[model samples]
Target: MSSYPPSVPPQSSAQQASQPTGLRQRLADLRGPAVPPRPLDARALAALAANPGCGRRALLDGAGVDKTVLAEALGSPAPFGQSQFAIVRGNSFEAKVKSDGGAELLRLVHAHLDPGGEAPGPDARVPDLSAAGPEGRAARTALALREATAAGAWTLLDHPMLALEVAGTPAYLEPDAVVVHPDGRWTVVEIKSFPMIDGAADAAKVGAAARQAAVYVLALERTAGKLPGARAGHTVLLVCPKDFSNLPTASPVDVRRERAVTRRQLERLTRVEELAAALPAGLGFGPERTAEERAAAVAAVEAAYAPECLAACELAFHCREKARAADEVTALGRSVRGELGALTTVEGALAAAAGPGAAEDPTAAALYRAALLRAEALEPVG
Candidate 1:
């Protein structure tokens, strides 16, 4: 049900021969009958950066299958829901920041990123980027960015939608704002409702903001690469409330390290074209179909489940349910998986610790020794 343009660029004979003939058809089929693909946003892509080994997330995301619906059908819904209060507060804060044709936003960027550079005048270009859909808007934004960079003037793109290709699929991202400096460099801006008390915000929240901005930086760089002399700056500007008040405060967060990590993780994702080849025939992962069929189709793919997924992945609850039912050691955590070595199941670990094989493997022997020590300590003093 995605509004994807049907036509792809013509492929050469060698390229045609290299790929499976019906790769796109296979992907379309995977979405089930007439199911629209869920577009991956910057936040979702950032979550992927946190856990690269999650094949289930990669396949589900690449195929554009709605994981929230799938998770509910599996009877283990993801524990994620935004409160009305937070949503209203965030929207209000963002609107206030960009109220004056982004005059306030430009001021923040100038002060934080380039106070020494040219200051943006009242005539700074803030082009209207709204379009029919995400794809159209992204294309419009890219055009505006290129033109702005070429002119080498102070420009601000407010809520500009960007598209980044991940594992052969296009993921759309919309940053709060992006500033094009007079020197033909672009900077990502993140606006948050969290209070920056005493000129400092929570470290965890700041880290999350940096990761999200880094995704935008990556997308911008891809667009800028096509135009000569245009570059996307690695440092991002974060705007937040100051001391529980409505006033805004800005800080430049350097995301070079986060950008490198995200780039590596994105590259490591399994290619969708290759994953499609391995799927079973007539598989349907759509919510419109029967739950049993959807479950079976999803089960066909292997998943690397870990407790950390609970906080990030929408399918975490569903995967956790399956892993717990199977007593998978990875359901505990990644550290537990390493400690168990080849024993991937809880029963297997317990059996090995109690059996003769405990003495063979160092990991098993260590677990057995720790268990005995605990048992001895729990015994009554006699």
Candidate 2:
């Protein structure tokens, strides 16, 4: 399978302008341009920034930015500064965590693949008994172990200790179960009530879960980073249900997959560490009036919530409170290069409107082409 996951491309402004034939279409999407984002309370901001992606949730939840201001900031066309850039970067890396088919397959292999495990027995019907909470998790663990022992191909680990922590962050692990295989290796199991989806539980949703498992793997490694007495390899297994109903069937996650995904994404984590190094930890974007010069940096954003700023904000109800006072219709504001800016600016709030793939808009996704045409008209780069 291809190692890289799929991604969506960004849209351009110029291509959007040509789409709308009517004036009203442009009036609807006026939030393309606005003042720079304000200073933020990083913690409050993640809630606003939260998406379905798990990694985005974990990392942003760690940083403490203000959601309202960040929401306002994202609506603007300006490129993000280093701090904002770092936060957005975190969202990308974290988006990769989640559980998938591989995890589900592992669970089946663990139970049925054993040497002489009993016939599905009394619990043959349950698709995932592991998600049954303490009683279920414990019972499932015991039954699975007995089957493993009979099969001879499997072995159950006892109270194996596991922990997942990065160099500077706290370990937020509460491993529900751990098992050792006949291969002398071990597996950690995380049971979930939700049905399994592709990459839904892997680093895609619980990206940190892999890192968390890595920490446990590290802990198992005991400083040398290797598990002693046990086999040379151990994996973190994520156990989840196979379907939405009360099916006893469950799935198992492979640790190696977690390791592979985390290694790539961990590179994206440095910005968080770098920014944390540069600024005081408890920085707040709003209410910085106590310091004279500091307040100037965010004055425009701090003074009022510009109508454009709140266009896509989840806090629309909050923004609507201020909509009555100002011209919310012009959220995109004047273009930066004026004409050049206009070409690349958000077209929704203009005389014409364009959305991503809005081939009907004033421009197709061809704002860059328009910009290029203009740039080409300018004197050579010499």
Candidate 3:
């Protein structure tokens, strides 16, 4: 996730009411005093959306706590780090695509997304969005978007900062680019280094990129809603490398489904203040705190762990350790946890497969039959 300087904007009456008094201070206390809160980006928000039920992640993230640092302090540091080569390659490719005032990038957008509209010409505008801070940059981006929409000309706002209110707090997001069509429609542009082979890319990487782009689309809608005759397009431009080459390729990814799912999940997330208020008093994850203290503080909240979390969450290793120590069925996987039904522990599942009352439950009966088959197979081999 990207980091930017933190800014606190004035809250409206509705926002103030939604966030209780002293909640921000309390969250600050939960994080170390004098430590800057980590600003969340689209990637973190997408991960949070993927596991909305995990209040631990929601609270930790909303509090602006640095889970990577906290994980290191707890001795279970997250194994999530991008290779330097990948980062350099991504930057180089993005620079190449956006070179010459985004001539190539605009061409791709015109070709793939808006073929019927006017083609981008040399006069296509690339707005400068520089400002004092993230808040200022966000305002600048909004102004540029509004002006671009009204002009009815092809324009690109490169790396524009957009502000999204997540659980009553503002999160600033920066997309690769935003294109304004001649018809006053805005489309998100995501530039990635992954290769699209034979008109296809890795489905997992594509899905991840689409989810991240969906977040940009959602934020764009919030800004476009206030502009007359302006709308954010559900289909976003996904630009990637073409099959083992550095040359950029474009594909249109429709993120309506992803947008809906992310929006619903974000709405379902418990407010950060409320989650903090429910915690016990005097809980802190500061560096001054001992390892045991930090562990206990983290354990105060519940976590829904699955194998998939290993990829998305910084605290997956710690949560997995806890789940395995308790023999929780969720440690196996989400599908296995669901399939086991009422058997919520590995011990319980084993007992159901070998002990009494197996006939009373469908899952248990199936497990019992499978266990008998395994025993027969082993005995015959012996």
Clashes of each: 0, 57, 0
The C-alpha TM-scores of every prediction are 0.88, 0.36, 0.91
**Candidate 2: misplaced stretches above 4 Å?**
1-109, 112-161, 165-167, 196-224, 229-245, 252-258, 271-274, 280-382
Deviation of model 3 at 103, angstroms: 0.7
Best by lDDT: 3
RMSD of each: 5.2, 18.6, 3.4
lDDT of 3 by residue, 1-382 (tens): 1212123332222223334569867877888777666777899899989989899999888877889989998899987867877777788888899999999999999999999879999999998998876777888999999999889999999889898888767687888899999899999998888889998999998899899999999999999999998999999999988999999999999999999999999998888878888889988888878988889899998899999999999999999999999999999999999999999999999998896576589999889988988888889552
Candidate order by decreasing lDDT: 3, 1, 2
For model 1, give the 10-residue run with minimal summed lDDT.
1-10
lDDT of 2 by residue, 1-382 (tens): 0011211112222212322433212211111122221111211222222221223222222332333444354342323233554445433322222223123334454663333543222222212333332323334544544455344343433222222233222222224344445544445554444345543534443443444454445344432233233532444555444454333344344556644444444433433333233333333333332333222222222122333333333333333343333534323332322343334433433323223444344444355455556667996777
Worst 10 residues of 3 by lDDT: 1-10
Instruction: Give me the overall lDDT of model 2.
Output: 0.35
Each model's lDDT comes to 0.81, 0.35, 0.86
Reference-based lDDT, residue 114, model 1: 90
